[model samples]
Target chain A: MFTISLVGPPNSGKTTLFNKLSGQKIKTVNYPGATVDYFSADFDKKYEINAHLIDTPGIISLIPTSIDEIITIEGIYSHPEFGTPDLIITTIDASQLSRHLILVNDLIEANFNVVVIITMNDILARKNFSIDENKLSEELNLPVFKIDLTKDNGIDELIHFIKTEVENNFEKRVINKISEDTFTLVNKYNRISEIEKKVLFPTKTNSKNITKDFNNLHKPDEISLKIDSVLLNGTWGLLIFFLAMSVTFASVFWLASPIMDLIDSAFALSSESILGIWGNNWFTQLLANGLIAGFGSVAVFIPQILILFLILGILEDTGYLARGAMLVDKPLSKIGLNGRSFAPMVSGFACAVPAIMAARTIPNKRERLLTIFILPLLSCSARIPVYLLLIGFLVPTTGSLTAGIILASIYLLSIISSLVAAGIINKLKNKVITEQDHSSFILELPTYKIPRLNNVFFNAYLSTKSYITGAGPIIMIFSVILWALTFFPAGIDNSIYNENDSFEQELIENSYASNIGKFLEPAVSPLGVDWRVGVAIITSFAAREVFVSSMALMFQVNISDEDSIQKSLLKNMQKAKKSDGTKVFTTSSIIGLIVFFIIAMQCVSTLAITKKETGSWRIPILQFFIYTFSAYFLAVISVNLINFFGIA
Target chain B: MKVRNASQLLNGEQSEILGIDYNHPSARRIIEVGFTPGEEIKVIGKSLFDDPIAFSIRGTVIAIRKSEASSIIIR
Candidate 1:
């Protein structure tokens, strides 16, 4: 089969165009290398023989600085098995054709049969710019197809053109050949100039029309000044950014609530029904307690995660994400990061697993590592239940608004700590210098179209499925082990100490004196945690959400009539005390614990991603130690400071 | 005195492009995308960020870099 490669610059809607043509809904991200993996689809028609359309990485030029670029270049030329692409389908954003043509010229000079796919035709029409198709075809002597990929316009025409060309084996006459010497040299412009005079001719009719048109349009200076007035010096831009983020957060909570509740209730019902049928056998208990409860914890969070990804994906698709990056670039850069760093860091708020994977977009290795290292500090959704549980008990005394403020403040603190940690690490490593001199605030602000619902739901489903399949097994096993640890030492009963309490409370009171709790009691004393909390922490390391399920299991066996796990946790925490009779979960200890979790490298999936990205255990191991030490040290200081202020 | 700004170039205006701000992200992007100085470039269109601007050069429809675009001294 003849191979045709789709090539373009980064963020030129190449993937979007490819998706439209190939009928594949590939995930499109804003940053470069988003499409790190290449894909190919077969095109077979009665009128034309079979052809393979391979989507390659977007490259600026043949000389590649990044891995993505190198892969694309190598894929085109160095394939020993596939040989070379028989044809190159170069897609150019219609509004950005001048820049797009550089690659076209190179491919033409390389002697590839090149067909230019002009995308974003709607943008071109809006700008009132019309390409003289015949004139352009005569100038380049190649077939040019204008397409609005998002609207699905001109697709059949494009396919028909491809069919006709392939059938005819159409080859454009080479009017200007690049010399061997010119090809070898680094001066790309000098070589292009050498060929330009022979291939290009200005038409009198088009020249007159262009001059009249130019005289009528707003001058470039006026437009630049207008942009500067709005973006560079205006509060409106910042306000828009914040407003967008607030809506994003609110939507994540609001839209996902119903779905989340449904999933939660379904699991609860299934577990209860299964327990009723199977009775209290060990296998039944495992199924009810281990599999259902453990997976349910993660499964419940999927709706929120999906909504977050969907909103993020839409912002990315609409091109507002680049603007967000640009707006925040200067501020982030002051702390030794860039605008591109924001996406993965924000993603950490949902889950650090994908956030760590998302860090691949950062070009600088040190920056990438630093971003991955500090991402866990973003107060991910896994911490929400723990925070809410503690906050609810304090709200009556502290006031509900104050407690909410404190909770929100802790999240802010996590972000600040992440930045400070990143800055400190960058300073210590002596790699604080920025190499991105080519930082352009300019972004292709794609026309704002209503976000496609199918695209949104499809992405959400795929992302949620991956998380369930990947993290589900680990969480289940961890919960089982935790259940087993607390379930043993069956003869020990604490009914005498809490005689007035129900059978469930008596069981949990016994659990505190269990062997597993006793083993971990000493280690958690400084953090003001008793044995039960210690066991919960250990189980949580498998996955952060497992903390909730572990607590649920602990409480489930201890209390028979407690309807709400949230309420039970609050009540248990309120009565809990330290060795000296001081409250175990004092305001200080609560703050300290929250702080520790915010900074700690608690997620194993994040560590796995680091291992995969770095291709070694060294970086992940180093990250593990650094984040753990930081979490511990910071938590200790916070607790001491809060105690000193008598805030507890 | 000579006019160097991309704005001075009319739509469908053909010019022998002299130089670009290689340090500019748009310039680098354009170069990376496939545009080189000394090529015959035709201005196709422009939008926000002075972006999605298109060019016809080297027998293909290539998009111009949005940043280094203003610095493209064309005649």
Candidate 2:
């Protein structure tokens, strides 16, 4: 099949154009030899064009500064897998033609079949300026499609152009010698300036024109300047940034909770119905606890992920994210990260996998690594259930102001820990990689526009889909394996059970997981938790949310509904005794558990993604051991200190 | 005209870029984004600490940290 690629600078509407052209939700995969996502899709048959289309990462020049740029430039000249593209459509922002043309000139000079598509025409028209497309096409000597995908205008002409002209008439051009010397860039800009002088004109000839003749076409966008005046004001801007972040986080936590509860109940109901019908057999147990519960853990996170991305999408579309980055850049740079790390860290609050992927935006490899390394300590939503469980044992009133304060403090602790960890890692990694230091922070503040709701929703849906597909199967498989670990070696005699002992409890006590937990009891004893909590901690290494299910199995809380399940678990936890006949869950022990969950690198999926993004197992392996050891050491110290203070 | 680092220009000040400091690592990147010699740039906004100053260049607003922006010599 024929292949075509869409290349452009960032904020050039290239991805939107690709979506409009392909008219489908596309799949994203890691580009060869890089973790940056590359979007590729086949053109819809309704267009009658059967070519493969690639939406490449945005870049300013052929000279690579970031991993994303390296992939885009390499993909254009020679992709090891897809080979070279038959045609490259370089999309340029009409208003920023001088800067955007640098890429087009490079592509044309390299002897590729380059076609120019001018975007942001409406923005130019608003500024009372317009490009003479015919003159531009003549000057560039390539096909120019001046379609406005936003209003669905000129698309038919573009489709017809591709259908009739691009079918087989394009010559097979060889890649020429590519040079990124200073003179070549200067010459390209000079040529672009000459062309701009000939083609640019005031939109209305009779009115007071902003342009001084045609030679100088540089007019700063007044609208953007006006908006930035208020939004980027030094004092007011920081306040607004924090307010916006708080609202987004609050909505994600509050708005998604009710829907999440509904999903939780739905999953629990199905699992219970299957068990009730199938009558307590091993098959029913596996289907309910192993399959349904595993699937439920993945499904329940959809609402929070969707809401977070939706708000982030709106902020991104309005061009506020860049400004937000600027607001936070100074403080972030103090910790060895730049403004770009802000967005990814905020995303980490929802899920670390997407957040790790988001770190591709950071151009500096060390900063990106530092950002990824601290992400797990940021209290991802998966830790919410575990925190709630332990907090319930600590706070008598579940919904009291004290409980809220405690919950918020735990989140605050996670945030503070991540920042501290980032600072430490940054200092350490800098020494090792000082020879190849490329720590630079350059950001573009795109003009603000009304957010397109369709695009925002589409992106939210896409991210939610990716999270499910990425983490779903692993959770399911691990839940089944965990089920087997806690279920088997069922040869215990009925006489071993006391009058109060439940059958499920006896089975779990006799299982291999219990043996392992008992084996690990000595190691965790200083944290003031028992062997049951030890088993739960070990089982949760697959994913943090598994701690809740493991806790339920360990306590033998067989309730189906959500509230009753928690209440029963709390009741069991409160009454449970240690091997010395003392209370197992004192205030000190709960504090220890909370601290451990906050710092431990428990999720296998996160480690897998870290390896994928960093392109090595060394960091992930180091991250796991370091975080785990520190978590345990800190937990032991915190438990002892709290005990010494006589809090419980 | 006297030359100074672009980072020294206050908000609302406009200047013509003289050349990039070749010793700086991000000199090429600043030049690639239309901050070449003779290009007119205006400081449009500044963040809290005035570290990452935003400038309007070629009709586009770009923000660069002061450490990197200092590489662009402007008059």
Candidate 3:
């Protein structure tokens, strides 16, 4: 099948053009590598034959620097699996024609069947400049089509031209025949200047100044400048960034609750109805208690993820994301990260999967790696439930202020730990923060434009879809396996229970899941953790939030009563005693458990995403070991030291 | 006009890039994004530390660090 690759420089709107051509709803983020990798779709009778339209990483030059750029280059030239693409659709920013044309010249020289689509003509036209299309085509010897995505100008012409001309002449132009001298960065750019000289002409010579005046052309600059005075003012910029992030964080909690509650009740209602019909047999037990509950627990977080994406989408679309980057770059650079790391690090507070994906915006290898390495330590919402359940035992407080302080402290702890980890790695293993890909820290702050609401909704929808699609099956498989492990050995007959709490509690104890927990009891017993904590730890590997629910189930807390669950779980854990009759969650033990949760690499989805993002198990493996060992030793030492000193 | 460091250029001042310190780390990407010699740029704004001073180059507003900007000689 013929593949047409859409290649362009950053900020060229390549993804928008790709979505327009492919009739797909893919989102376009402002930063480079926001898509992370190529997005391809088959022709849906939008053309004559079956062809793949691929949207690659928006790269500046052919010489690849970062991972995303390398992937794009590989897709075109070096991939062992996918052969070279047939036609190249180069998207050029019309206002920045001189710079954009350099990439066009490079592609043309490399002998790719090139069709240039000019975007942002409105911006150019607003500036009293316009390109003569036929003149440009004659100069470049390739068809140049100008598109206005909002209005659909030149799109139909683009399709018809590509269909006819490409079919006739492109099959044989596979080899790059242009000499090194002909395609040097200097030569291509020099030729691009010549083309600009020939084709680009000023329109409507200003009535005031008959010359081409760039300053007067950009009327929007006044408003933008005025806005930036407050928005990008150092102190105000920081304040606004904090406010923006706080709003995003607050919206995740406030706006999504109704939908989340609706989903929870829906799942509960379905499970109850399914159980009502299926009776109390094993099949009913598996469907009602296991599958429905398992999937529903995960499906509830969808709203929060969607809300985060919606806010982030608007921020990026409004071009405020770049300003946020600029605001944080200096501080983050001091800590061995760039401005790009700021967004992903903030996103880590949401979830690591998407945050790791977001880290691709960082062009520096070590900086990107450091961002990913530190991301998991950020106290995500998944850790919220774990913190709530554990902090109740750690400190004797249900007060609002104390709870808020504790929660904020955990987040603070996460940031400090990750920064320390970055420092350690810098000092010991890799000297990362000192050397950089670019000597100058240059980040483009796009002009403030009204964010297109459709794009925001589309981005949110796409982010939620991807998370569900990527993380769902693994969660399901783990849930099912967890169910089977806790259900098998085929009998409540093994442990005798007099009442409801004991019945559910012993049901897990006599099953295979508890046996696995018992297997790790020796390793954990030193930290004052019982077999139940062991089982909760094992179950939470699916996701950290599952630790709370799994604890609720293992302790047989009344799941039906949401209002009383937190109090009951704390009460049950407080009453829990070891085989030797010593209390399980003594003050020090609870602190140790809290420390472990704060540090341990317990989430499977986090590991999966880390492996995918770093493109190797090696980094994730090191990450896993470093985190788990630190968690283990720290927990053990805290427990032992407190006991030795008779402090708690 | 005599050449001066990009960090030394004041707000709203327009200048052309002369060159950058060849040995600096960010020199390559600086040039890659049209920061080469003869490129016209304006010092639009500056952050508190003058670390990330904003510049308008070829109609795009970009922020670069003053430490690295010092290497970017402009006149």
Candidate 4:
């Protein structure tokens, strides 16, 4: 298979072009050991042999400043041991060809056998800018293909070109000494300029058309000044960030309610049907109380996850994310971080896995690692269920809205704490890792286009499907284990336990006699949690959502109906007392628990990703320990502080 | 000397390209995006941020820092 590398600046439609030519839609993955993004596709052309196309990250220069740029440069230079690219297909937006020619020139100088793919030809046509293809080819001494990627024009021609070149082993010499002796060359020949002038001509006949059409493209300076005006001085930017965040949370809660209720009712119906068929056997009891309840708990939160992703996807696609990054950059810089860290941190609110993955964009190793380290501190969607359950139990119904406000406040507090912790860590550490000069933020604010519905729904479906299939089994198994832990040590008579209550409750009340609960009782007592909560916490380490299942199994409750489970948990927590005769979930313990969850490293998926991204287990392991310890210490302090103040 | 801010250059506006301050953040960004001093830059459009603007320079629609745009003294 022949390799063709597609290179261009960000938002130059390189990925769009790759999609058109290869007919493959793959998520761009960050190159390991570099912040640059790339995607590889195997193209099977009709006339041409199968070719491998590498879509490289955007770069403006051969000498790169940003991590992504550096990666692109390295990818270009580092000839793969297995295979080096046989041909390079450089894509440039035709309407903006002037800026793109730099990369073309650099590639030419690098001596790569190159072909230029100029995209957005329609835009050029509208602007009355005509590219004399033959003239350009003669001037540059290379093949040039122009297309509109969105319209899928010129793709077949491109494929045909690739096939022919690869088969014939076609080679073309590129100018490699543009900078080496350009001073002498400029003085000696001025010949290069003469050639350029002859080849490049502006059409004056349709100058009005050109001006009218050019209004469609964004001018970088005006946009920057506007952003500076708002971000640097105006309060509107901050207000927008806060307002958007508020709406996000509100939508998450509102959109999720109906789906959550449906899931609850479905699970409740299943439990009731199972109980009727099984007639109260231990196995039936386990199925009803442990397995069904456990899965149902986590499954209910799926709606919230879906809603959050939808909002974020829209914001990202609309190019508002870049503005948000710009808005937050100064505040972040004050704390020794930069604007690049904002995306990953925001992503952490959904799930830490992608947030950690997104950290690759940060460029600096220390900043990336620090961002990864503190990401778990953000109150991810996983913690929402725990918060809702606890807050509903403790706060009065009349002021539930105020309780929700408090929950939101705590999430903000967590972010602030994480930033503070990152700063402290940066200062305390003696290690001197070089930080990349901040790449002047020059993100292309892609024209505001209504997000494609097909793209949004397709992404949402794939994400939800993966979560259900990939993470579902682990949750089920954990539920079963939790059931066995509380269910085993068969009583002298199976009928010896109270007959009125369900088997689940019988097992928990008598759990001391059960082998598993007895084993965990000693270790969890210090945190003011019974062995039951400890077991849930441990199972949750696999995935925070599994806590719901663990809780259901531990409690031996078949309350699969969401409302029932909420009510039961609230009732149980309210009734239970510590050894000292105070309520177990006193105000302090609740705060402490929330704080613990805020700082705790609970998701295994995040750790796995960190290991993959860092190419080492050391960082993930270190992260786990640091976060776990932080959670424990903070929980202890919070509990004591609440007690000290007599708030409990 | 005619000094016009880059933002003022309408699409299809033809002017003598002068010099660029490569050290200026926006100027460096403009250059990085393939906009060199003396290169003809065509005004593109505006985005929400109103800075980090995009333009057609050297045959590519490159975005540069707005701060850099101020340094491009075009006649």
* Top of the candidates by DockQ: 2
Q: Provide the overall lDDT of each model, using Cα atoms, as 2-decimal numbers.
A: 0.62, 0.83, 0.74, 0.64
Worst 10 residues of 4 chain A by lDDT: A180-189
Query: Across residues A206-243, which tens digit of lDDT does each residue of candidate 4 receive?
Result: 45554343334324334544444453333666786778
Q: Give me the candidate number with maximum lDDT.
A: 2
- In candidate 2, what are the lDDT values of residues B1-75, reduced to their tens digit? 666899999988999887888778887788788888777889989998897999988888899999988888887
Cα deviation of A335, candidate 1, in Å = 1.9
TM-score of the second chain for every model: 0.68, 0.92, 0.88, 0.67
Residue pairs that clash (backbone atoms under 3 angstroms), model 3: A438-B26, A439-B25, A439-B26, A440-B26
Compared with the true structure, what per-residue lDDT tens digits does model 1 show for residues A1-648?
A: 566678887656776766655633343222232322566666534324367667776765555554445556777763434547777788876555555566776777767778877776565555455555555666678888777776767777878877766677645444333343422333655443333333333333445565454332212223433443443332566677778887887677668767876987798778878867865545665687667887787788787777788888888765567556656665665566666788888777777766776676665555666677678778777776666666776684533578768776877788888888877876765533232333333333333345666656765566655556555666667666666655444413333324553433344445533556668788666676666667777777877767766666554434344545556666767776666787777887777777777777777766776676656787677777878787878787888898888886
Candidate 3 per-residue C-alpha lDDT over A260-286 given as tens digits, one digit per residue, 9 for 90 to 100? 768867886787788567644567667
Q: How many backbone clashes does candidate 2 have?
A: 0
How good is the docking of model 4, by CAPRI class? incorrect
Docking class of 1: incorrect
DockQ of 3: 0.49
Alpha-carbon DockQ of candidate 2: 0.76
Q: Which sections of candidate 1 miss by over 4 Å? A: A1-4, A10-13, A23-53, A71-87, A109-113, A126-128, A132-141, A148-154, A161-229, A232-235, A396-400, A430-473, A487-516, A555-562, A577-583, B1-75
